[model samples]
Target: MKKKRSNAWLYFFGALGGVLYGYDTGVISGAILYMKEELGLNAFTEGLVVSSILIGAIFGSGLSGRLTDRFGRRKAIMSAAVLFCIGGLGTALAPSTEYMVAFRIVLGLAVGCSTTIVPLYLSELAPKESRGALSSLNQLMITIGILLSYLINYAFSDAGAWRWMLGLALVPSIGLLIGIFFMPESPRWLLSKGKEEQARAVLSRMRGEKRVEEEAEEIKEAERQEQGGLKELLEPWVRPALIAGLGLAFLQQFIGTNTIIYYAPKTFTNVGFENSAAILGTVGIGTINVLMTLVAIRFIDRIGRKPLLLFGNAGMVISLIVLSLTNIFFGDTIEAAWTTVICLGVFIVVFAVSWGPIVWVMLPELFPLRVRGIGTGVSTLMLHTGNLIVTLSFPILLEKIGISSLFLCYAAIGIAAFLFVFFKVTETKGKSLEEIEQDLKDKHRGSLKTETRTAEQ
Candidate 1:
């Protein structure tokens, strides 16, 4: 019950899911350099290979809620780990571009599953007192995983060992598979399934003896007050939450964040950095990303969500504007290269502290117990679908519209996202799930009143 075994270690293992996603993202940025030559890929084919994982992720997220609800979080995660191992190995050994694309899809499925499951799993398992910080381990490790991938990219650049770049993901995937074997199923999940005694035992260790029964009772009461499924999501009282959730998940991908994480190497090359310098620069960027995410995790509970989202978007808008101007004025000159790097660093720092972790934390928290699974799946599907669109389109955009034009577009999206948060999003800081739902209901009633007045007039 005391959990002398250390929940931190368990969380670390659980977050290996994030590590694989990061690794998959980072490896491709640099590997594409060699893969272009080996696979005879033009821009379109290369984009397909890189975006294949995102395509796979769409499927994974779409199905995650059903899988996790029916089979349990532990099993869903274990299934993902298996996919990671197979995908990592298959990708590294693929003899042709077509085979490589297939393998990346496999890896994408693993990433999608993790994105849907890991944060929710950690949130359900952690004590309320430390929920934000602990649940943030998913984002934290993802930054670490990206950093490791960049390091690998740099280390292998001279040797041209792109195969090793991808194959190494297998090591951690296997570790995740074994580590999951030890974790008890989520206590909240057990309670949802009516396995109260098993749920209490998990809670005794996750929280403590004094809190287990109380927390269990709270979950049961909340469940009693709610009705669930796809239909429930369309209710007037619930529509705002769904809109807010989907917006956060979707924009979080397109606010120009993944461009840096997924295409930093390519962007640098376009700006005149050599292959090795570009890869190393990516490592520096990845390091900044991880550090900022850590700082955000430390202060998120104290600072709350809405303020951070607003503040971070302000920084992103400014950075994207400066980068767009630089690219327009200097083109591929040396100064433009340096300016792009600095602006990207600023963008990643702000984004790391806010949207990256906050969105993931808010997703599971925003929904009621009855509809959490369906709601989570729907939003996650949108999140990855947005990711796929951005990833698939970036190369084509860069080629057709030019990088300056692309930066301007992202900057515009950033402004729109800021306005949405200001006008529409509610702050859920320090509120339990039930409390958040009540707040949303109050707003929903106001919305109905406004609609009624309009109709009567």
Candidate 2:
């Protein structure tokens, strides 16, 4: 009972980080209209402004692993909170577009770190029995953040109050910082740093005195087996796991989820809605995303990861195809606008319930302890790289190929993603980290022998 209480607090703090992430991402969509007018941003510059954070995210995600390893997840998250404050205030008060872009990159650093470290921290701290549900709190908090942002933005949308929209993130940043101050550090991280006594103390506080010693021993053994660097991740047997980690990461972004998310308002306008309705419609999309994420949190463990992935991908393909056909057939009529909105809402629902949470859950779980940090870093890098590609191209693609073609392209990628998940990915629901690692290694070795036998034949 005491352990459960302690874990509840840990998850509460971890979810705080997710709220900040959601706030940051969600704020921009609403703020962009006002920011563009105030900053006199042209279409090209608007795209740049919107995507600058993603560029910053690439570096942030790549570096966060090393920072977390050196500083510990607790401190790293605290540092990100500080960055969020700076970024949020800076962006809100920017004197010019250049300053806004620079501040956004700063915000991106925090966003990137939170995105990678929060889930990892939760996973490490959570008891194995509750890890899936607790780790998923990150997504739930994220959706809540989005929903909160949408509501905040809606309330403030009347007077072009984008500054407040951007600045509102400061509330959660402050909240997260304060909340984290009272939270315990991950025992796994403490053990990794040879702070075995400290690890036990934390575990005892969270898991009771009876279980602390055993749990500490398991964590210490796991840490002892870990290599903890980039070169260690390059071993031959690690390759398959790496590919799975990075491939899933890449697929999560490459399926064009962000095109809908970051550009929902503009995409809606392109279909035929007026600006007012488009902005209002985005709130609906945000709501669906939040609700479906709730569904995912509820069912991820119950139904398992693969079913959700397959279902989401299949659903997205159909939705995207319909979205494209709607655009092609109706050509910016109100009918097309409503169809696009409905289909896009479905797309958001499908994605939020599957890839949004599962990718984060699986990435850290799939790799063995030895190279988990490096493997996660590499995979996160791929995730951001894919994010950057879509972020940079989506606007340009919208201009060049038109909306129908863009959706068609995304639908095609969704099909590819479904195929990959079906054949390549393993079912990992309900497995412990060590067990999953062994399963991966066994499969890796078996595949290699088959390859050699075929070559010899």
Q: Number of clashes in every candidate structure? A: 0, 1
- Error (Å) of candidate 2 at residue 407 is 0.7
Q: Compared with the true structure, what per-residue lDDT tens digits does model 1 show for residues 1-457?
A: 3355677788888788999889998789999988888999998998898889999998998888788878889999999999999999999999999999999999988988999899888877776656777788899989999999999999999988899998998888998999999988987778888899999888887777998778888888877777777788888788888999899999998887887888999999998989999999999999998999999999988888899999999999999999999989888788999999999999999999999888888888787776776678778889988888888889999999999999899999999999998987888777766677778778878888999999999
Cα lDDT of candidate 2 equals 0.83
Q: Kindly provide the TM-score of model 1 when superposed on the true structure, using C-alpha atoms.
A: 0.96
Which residue pairs in model 2 clash with each other?
226-370
Q: Per-residue lDDT tens digits of candidate 2, residues 28-133?
A: 7777867787899877788888888877777888888888877888998999899999999999899999998999899889878888788888888777666777
Q: Top lDDT: which candidate number?
A: 1
Clashes of 2: 1
Q: What would you estimate as the lDDT of candidate 1?
A: 0.88
User: Candidate 2 regions off by >4 Å?
Assistant: 1-3, 444-457
TM-score (C-alpha, index-matched) for candidate 2: 0.95
Top candidate on TM-score is 1
lDDT of all predictions: 0.88, 0.83
